[model samples]
Target: MDKAARKAILRELREQERARWWATLGLTSAQLDALHEHILANLIDCCSGELELSEQWANQVGVDWSRLEQALMELGGYCDCEVEANVCPD
Candidate 1:
């Protein structure tokens, strides 16, 4: 395949993988983006060493806290800062 074709194929595969990853956590790309932004903004103060900020954002956005927390924990996001560091889009 040509270089452009290869790049496009890789991009498509990445999109598919991202979709599957977010789907497993019951979150859409937009939701993840919002969550990332929210956590990032809050982390400016300090990481409460917990998911307090994440849970607040999830509650505001009407996402299931339990499910999201479970997924985050599985991905090594045991805290708000960890979530920003670990659970983010590429």
Candidate 2:
């Protein structure tokens, strides 16, 4: 597919995901960024390797962990590998 097509596809997917998130709970962009950082640093691999994910390479930013987890679960819990039933998703 062409670049424009790929961008459209990605944008559509994000819209769908955002809608799904809104349906579950109201969220703010900062909340999303917090959870994203947490997941990258903890759950995802950050090593320099062929399989390493670029998202995890950024510097850690301060975040309120509990609040961020709550927001992420509400917004993108299904996308998470597995969340502890008792604990909120990241």
Candidate 3:
């Protein structure tokens, strides 16, 4: 209803959404990195930040694409929804 109340609601929603991202999956960055590296290692010689890893390789290496996608989406949500806008214009 008021400014303070709206801010409090936003903060609470942000926290809950963030928790679902990192905590619900129960995965650390290191673990996710390992999965990526494993896929990259077997499917790619060197990523160089430009490699299209195959789905077969992903299946073979057991990469958790859904979780990674979810994490990335959540990070985007944090940046877009929680961060102040236009602090530094491009």
The model with the greatest lDDT is: 1
Clashes of 1: 0
Model 1 — TM-score against the truth?
A: 0.75
85 Cα displacement, candidate 1 (Å): 2.8
List the RMSD of every prediction in angstroms. Answer: 3.7, 10.5, 9.6
Pick the winner on lDDT between candidates 1 and 3.
1
TM-score ranking from best candidate downward: 1, 3, 2
Please say which candidate is ahead in TM-score: 1 or 3: 1
| Top candidate by TM-score | 1
Worst 10 residues of 3 by lDDT: 77-86
lDDT of each: 0.85, 0.46, 0.46
Residue 18, model 2: Cα distance from true site in angstroms:
0.6
Residue range 1-90, candidate 1, lDDT tens digits:
899999999999999988876977789888999998998876755687889999999899999999999998887788888888844332
- Show where candidate 2 strays beyond 4 Å: 26-90
Q: Residue 58 in model 1: shift from native, Å?
A: 1.3
Tens digits of lDDT, candidate 2, 14-36: 99987776444344656545545
Candidate 1 Cα misplacement greater than 4 A, ranges:
86-90
